[model samples]
Target: MEIIRINERPQQVTPRGVKARAVLDVPYINIMNLTLAPGDEVPSHTTPVDVLFHIIEGEGSVTVGPETAKVSAGEIVVSPAGIPHALAANAGTHFSVLVIKTPNPKNMAKSG
Candidate 1:
């Protein structure tokens, strides 16, 4: 059995300045934890693959394509392939969520 300890992973700062940690990376899927401080946001951007956001803690807003919603822990949001998506932490609190990208975009590049 393989074990992945998310907290043990080194934190990486994305281009948008959000704190993140790569939790899982494989040929089929990629998963990462994103932590955003109050007022922090991951700007809207388009990706070539489907994305799933699983809320881990705190509250935040998620925008997938044209719709946006305030999501809290235990909620899951889906962003279809080739669409724009973004995330923002609510004021006065921190937000953490798991970002899962299916089919692993890196592998998609290698095969496409």
Candidate 2:
């Protein structure tokens, strides 16, 4: 069995400029922990694989397709493939989420 410790991973800046720690990058899935400081954001973009964002701590605004909503810890947000989505930490709080990509795509390039 393999064990992954979230906090032990080095934080890296994503292409969108948000801070994230890659957890898994296997053929079946890709997972990362994304942390956003107050007012930080992940720019809107569409990917080829379905995405799932699970709020791990704090709260944030999530935009999927044409709809946007506020989500707090314990909530899960879905973003289907080919749809634009983004995330932002509330102005006064931090936000942390687990980003999961199922059936990991060969090309993770933004489609839009």
Candidate 3:
């Protein structure tokens, strides 16, 4: 068995410019903790694997495909594979979220 303490991970800037910490990365799945400061945004992007976003702190706007909604802590959002999705922090609020990607994209491509 393995254990991970989310708060203990070092947050770093992701390639997309958001602060993120990779919590888990394995063949089957990947998990990350992301923080978006006020005014920060993650541009829409499509993934090869399905994704779930669990809001951990603050409020933000989440866009999945053509639908967009204002989300807050304790809420969750799903973005299916190949669909564009994005997240943005409210004008003066910080947003923290747990990002989970299933069937690791790399592994999925290998199995195809």
The lDDT per prediction is: 0.95, 0.91, 0.94
Model 2 spans with C-alpha error above 4 angstroms: 107-112
lDDT of 1 at 104: 93
Residue pairs whose backbone atoms clash in candidate 3: none
In candidate 2, what are the lDDT values of residues 1-112, reduced to their tens digit? 9999999999989878889999998877999999999999998988888999999999889999999999999999999988999999998999999999986775444332
**Per-residue C-alpha lDDT of model 1 across residues 45-107, encoded as one tens digit per residue:** 988889999999999999998999999999999999999999999999899999999989999
Q: Score candidate 1 by lDDT.
A: 0.95
- CA displacement after TM-score superposition, residue 13 of candidate 1 (Å): 0.6
Q: Itemize residue pairs with steric clashes in candidate 2.
A: none
Candidate 2: deviation at residue 28, Å? 0.9
Top-scoring candidate (lDDT): 1
Worst 10-residue lDDT window, candidate 1? 40-49
Off by over 4 Å in 1: none
lDDT of 3 by residue, 1-112 (tens): 8789988999899999999998998999999999999989999999998999999999999999999999999999999999999999998999999999998887888889
Candidate number achieving the greatest TM-score relative to the actual structure:
1
Error of 2 at 30 (Å): 0.3
